[model samples]
Target: MWDLDVQPLISSSKWLQLHGLKRNKLSFSQILSQIGFQHREDFVSTLGKFVASRYADGLFPQYLRAQDGRVYNLTAKKELILHFVDCLTGAIELYKQRMEWVTSESRQLFGVIQESCITIVLDFGTVCRAEFDLCRDALSMVLSQQVAQLANDIIFSTAQDLVKWQQKAVPVSEDSVESAVKWLWKLEHMPAVSHTSSTEALLEAISDETIEAVYYFAVGDVPKDMKHLLLQKVSNSPYAIHTVSFNAREEETIIFLKELSQLTSGRYGEYYYCYYDLLISLILKAIQVGTRESLQRLLSHLAHNKKIKWLNGGRELTVK
Candidate 1:
């Protein structure tokens, strides 16, 4: 028999060891050897900060599984990691400025990191929770109310499946998915519907389902416990739930995201795009408006520094 089991070698620590580093114990020099590259750690380190500012988004590229647990790592990407670091550095500076301007008496901000919904950010201190909720509700109503028509047509293999499915589904309410829960959870088989259905109509349709399964959205960064819950929810789903990510500087966007999250595999979140908290703090602190224009300028600065590479978008233009 072989001396080693193929499993333990794939452990998170082992995974990091193969790459020659530990995540929290991160250092430039250690990372280089771990990933089997002989590049300068100092140079790579710079790029990580930049990525956080304008482009640090979504799942890390590297992944490891030891035992039954899983983790997505980013240290492997020499370029991407550095870019993110540079961006984070800039983000912190801006954050500092905002903190300085906002007196503790008038406003306070709270930040939390969740494990399961790794992408969702819940960023609001207790003082501003009410204001944050108001903006989020407004945003959700817009997405639900302002849906565009998506009259997609689908053809079945034959009359039997078509008639059988139609007969099964037509009686369901066409309002929100919430209404269709009974049908979804109890029914033995179901056909997936298109996302174009109006929110009101969709819920109505949901009511007709005898066995409707309610899918939960991860509202904040997922914790390990939460991750298991989500996995259980989507175990039978055909589609993947890539995180629905966006930046919400104001109430409108926040609300839109909340409503949209319900339709997706689940809205797993990282940072709270609160109206009164993150936005107001940043504004007061002098974090430049995160408009398309300002973002471009930040991107340009990273590109010029070579901390970030501009592979797409305009190449000729330069930012000062």
Candidate 2:
């Protein structure tokens, strides 16, 4: 048995010798210790390289289990892990790029519409849900009091309306024309002590200020229970409501948002994957035509055959 052990030790020593390690003793433990140390050093170096490769390639492994239970070569396993790391790295970089692009595009779009005196009603309750940085950046571009007031009013009204609608047993129509006519009549002829006192405050605030356009940035779908009531309030308003739905997927939600815009004779647009592109397009169109066309069209319907020549186009347009 001693001889058998000695023979294997000698064979291992010879193998080490072949690999350029000159050893005099045929001790199994000593040979194994040396080999193990060298192997560990090699493994650490290879691991560093694998990490670097993954970072550079921006990828990572999708699966750890092989198709069959057969043993894989150690080198192949390392390569697979490296590939996975590469994919993960790539995905992160791409996301950063998209966010940067969106920010830049939004800034540019806002710049174009800032002087248009457009009242942008940013729905903090929806999709983007009023992310701080995004809202700050957008608000920074426009310094109009009307825009600021509108933003606050929309947010407040959304919350207040949701609560009020939930408490009330009355039913509101979703049709734009009927809602608008009824609401207008109520506002013009009715007393301020009516049930729509809160709505009257909102309308009075906006009407008192000169507003060219009302852009509603919907981040998500409105709650189903509040849809009809909210729509009635929005449609009844005198201001044209331009609804821009972002990242909305539900068919009913899309239709509802679109219908609101249509009912108010406002523009409706949807942005799924690229919000920046959609916003840029909307702003560009607004800049090209100017809000004068919309104002004139609105006036034509309300005034009915009155020849209205707009003097000093540079002055902010106000609907009285």
Candidate 3:
């Protein structure tokens, strides 16, 4: 006496096949991994998509007409669909509970990044005041106050160094080895008030284990010798260095920073006034090494939410 609408199940089967999932063999575990195993909420959200799709395909009718034109009870089919839905829900709930248990046991583990230290190197020597403003604005929006305070402590001296170097009698050419050595010495030994010794001090202050990340805000060309020395130190450090470039017009500088990011497994971003746009770019870069499945999930979510518009007849993502 158990019966249900056959049409919706038929559509759901077709939908599963269209998505390359074997309908007959579908399981909660498979679905969870497909969505994203790292985040329980994402798994649940994706499961909701399948549920919605089945509902949209008319999964709720109480009766159905067979191919033979005979009216049939849909109670059994409804029960089956409900059972599957319940399975998905139960799985997500169980996973969520487990996550809660783990979180409770390791209360100090979560959000520990906020407690870590990050060094921010501001290239004030080459960057103009306008560029500095942009850097400040971006940092204010993206960084937490604690992190900002850490950055501020080191940034003051680095800025002052640029000003001191600018006022010096000797012309410090970008390629001068003598100038590079002189500034490098100043950066290491000079007091914060005498020179912008922030970089060396920042590097010295952070141990390989204590430092979380390094942010280099570059506005203009970096001297060849200084760049070499900085890159050497960064390579030896355990943490990655993320470079944010502002109005970097020099070809060599751009290439150098880009290569530095790539070699160190760090992120490189060009500062755009639009923080959202910049964030998206950074996210894309971070996930460039992820699996195709991950990319597909992201794209599907973006498409379904209408956050991205398709262009070139759906072959391209429209820049909005």
Maximum-TM-score candidate: 3
Candidate 3, 170: how far from true, in Å?
38
Candidate 3 per-residue lDDT, tens place, 1-320, comes to: 11122111112234236432244334644443333222111235645642212332333232323444322223334466676677666545544543443333111111111223454555544443333454554443333322332321222214335333222122213333234334433443212242234356336434434456666666545567666766666555566666666655456877887877676666666632322443364358549858776566555434433333333443645433
Residue 135's lDDT within candidate 1 is 31
Candidate 2: tens digits of C-alpha lDDT, residues 1-320: 12221211112234336422224322433333322221111235645642212231223222222544222112235565465456546545544543443334432233122223444444434322113234434444332312332222221122223221111112222332233233322321111122343333334334534555566655445567556665667676676666666545467878988898788777676654323333344456557778986445444433431222222445533223
lDDT of 1 by residue, 165-258 (tens): 1323222123422333222233223222322122222232223333222212223222334334433443343322223322323344344434
Candidate 1 residues lying further than 4 Å off, grouped into runs, are 1-138, 141-217, 239-242, 245-320
Q: Model 3 scores what on Cα lDDT?
A: 0.44
What lDDT is reached at residue 272 by model 3? Answer: 25
Error of 1 at 120 (Å): 16
- Positional deviation of 236 in candidate 1, in angstroms? 2.7
Better TM-score candidate (1, 3): 3
